[model samples]
Target: MEEPIRILYVINALEVGGTEGQLAELISGIEKERFSPYVCCLRTIKDKSSYSLDCPIIALGVSRLMSLQTLIGMLSLVRYLNHNRIAIVQTFFIEGTILGVVAAKLAKSVSAIVVSKRDLGFMLTKRVIWQLKLIYHFADRFLANSKNVKDYLIKKEGVNRGRIDVIYNGIDIEALEKKMQEVSGADIRSREGIPEHVSIVGICANLNRKVKRVDLFLMAAAIVCKYLKDVFFVIIGEGCLKKSLLDLSEHLKIDLKTRFVGSQVNPIPFIRMFSVGVISSDSEGFSNSIMEYMGCGVPVVATDVGGNRELVEDGVTGLLVPCGDAEKMAEAIQVFLDQPAFRKKAGEEGKKVLLERFAKNKMIRDHEFYYASLTKEKRMAFKKKRGKFSA
Candidate 1:
């Protein structure tokens, strides 16, 4: 039997964000018979217990990007790649992409280098863009989570369209459904002191980035409060902007109606309680939050930016509003709040779409095919080069 091809996934951290969650799911679900998976985190793992993976995880303990530690980490990565004869090096986030791509190139043994693009370059600066462009040619492939992101790469970064592949993010429907079955929304609400009769409008997003535009979610909640007094707003996830966002909620006079529940390991219960789930991001690659919402059979109100339009079928599965328009978002949310039948129908449609289009099995299969094809191409080219040398 042929040995499993070894693949290394490099990322900044193994925390509870969209990228980290997707990486965890992918590595966990990937068929071990065909591919062996490993993870290398650029930063130290603060809580090792948070991630329960079957593969080995190596942390470089890197603190600063331009320090001796980072230099040492890069060298260690190259040594590790060569020592393991890594066939594929897949990287996530900016730091991991910059470091992993270059290190994999230096390793010489690495057959393929894949860089993942999950966002619309909303946080990228001019210098960062230049830095990324410098190493773009070194990568074998660019994996985009959404078609919108692929377009952004081709248009903004001037990447060759042929070099990019779009694979939508997937969720483990069975696992999520099982958890939803185990945890009741009423129990969660009771624990949080929320009334059973009050409608819950919730959002699950990190408060660390302004791109998420959680502030808009709050503003819209304030608007929803004027007409629906029985509505309660729930904000899931934690970040640096939590304090400021708390102040903003208070300033909007929706503080009493809002609950800022910090970073949940499993937000399925809170999601289960939501009458409507919202994504107020100024931009997104593809929304894991929207998928989670749909998996729980909850309707969504999202900004029509990035891959949101792809996930949300406007007026069918959910409503799509203009980005940065809090009033428009509030109006969409109100539509769901007023009509329970339409909301339920939309939620059902969302679940059907999610099951059909974004299953974890489909994602894993797509990746396996992509990786196997790339590895084969590399081997063929190498064999041709060896024949030339012998001749």
Candidate 2:
């Protein structure tokens, strides 16, 4: 009998977001017999306690976005990785990706350094592109979670297309099933203060300007509510734009139709509350919220952006409108509201796709295979050279 292969997953923090959620799911679903997973966050934030993924998590308390702290953190990570006899270093996000690669390379025990590209718009700028080019060279493998990200690295940044592999993000369809089942059991209308008579349109995300484009969603919500008086827009999750969107809704005299549920630690409850889910992002990697919505059998209308088309099938699964076009977005929302049978059919199709394509167990296996492939030192060296170093 052989000891389980050790993998160290590096990310920024376990805050409540898509990245954090996926990381937890990835670890929870990994085959424990073959792979023992350890997690390390560059910044020590709170452990997201929603799911019961009891994997050991390490955090080096560091200041946010400070280079000095990041560098110190990287050094600490190397020491930790080496001490733990970690064979594979898998990093996510920019800060984690850059530091994890160098730390893995520095640790002789680490057979390969893997950098998972979780965000498509990450390092999309001309200047930071140079940095990606530099740091990417240190990696033994570039695991892209979407074709959009893989294409960006190759076409946009001139990285080797051959080196990039599209590994779709996995979701717990079973947990999603549980979410849907649990929704029916709870008296959510009374608990959340949602009016039973009002039709709920839910958007589960951070109130950010660039990515989420929640302002546009609010504008569309106003337009939709004008025609549908019994409609109510529920914006779940909070950020800087919270106050701004609240003010805008008040000024438009549709504040009554809109409610900021604030940043929810667990969005499952709120997602289950909605009759339809909406995603109005300018850009995205794979959206888990939409997946969760679909799992809950809630129809969705999302913007046509990176990896969004992958999650949603227009006229089949859920409607996808052109990004930034609030009118089309609103119209799509109306389409779902108007045709209950169409919405239900689309939601059903989404569930089928979710079960077949985005299974959490499949995701864990893909990553395990990826980790095993990295064990070959020769392959790791080739990957490191082909990916190119930024600086």
Tens-place lDDT per residue, model 2, 1-391, is 7678889888877776777788888887788888899988787656456445667788877656456877788788888888889988888887777777888889867877777876666436787777877988887677787888788768776678777787788888666656555444247666556678877898988776447888888889888987887788888887788888889889878887777878865567677767789998887878888888887778889998888888888889998899899899889898888887997898889888988888888888888887767675556676788889642
The lowest-lDDT stretch of 10 consecutive residues in candidate 2 is: 177-186
lDDT of 1 by residue, 216-307 (tens): 99999998899889999999989999999999999999999899989987899889889999999999999999999999999999999999
Cα shift from native, residue 349, model 2 (Å): 1.0
- TM-scores of the candidates are 0.97, 0.90
* Model 1: lDDT to the true structure: 0.93
TM-score of 2: 0.90
What is the lDDT of every predicted structure here?
A: 0.93, 0.79
Candidate 2's displacement at residue 347, Å, is 1.0
Q: What's the CA error at residue 10 for candidate 2, in Å?
A: 1.4
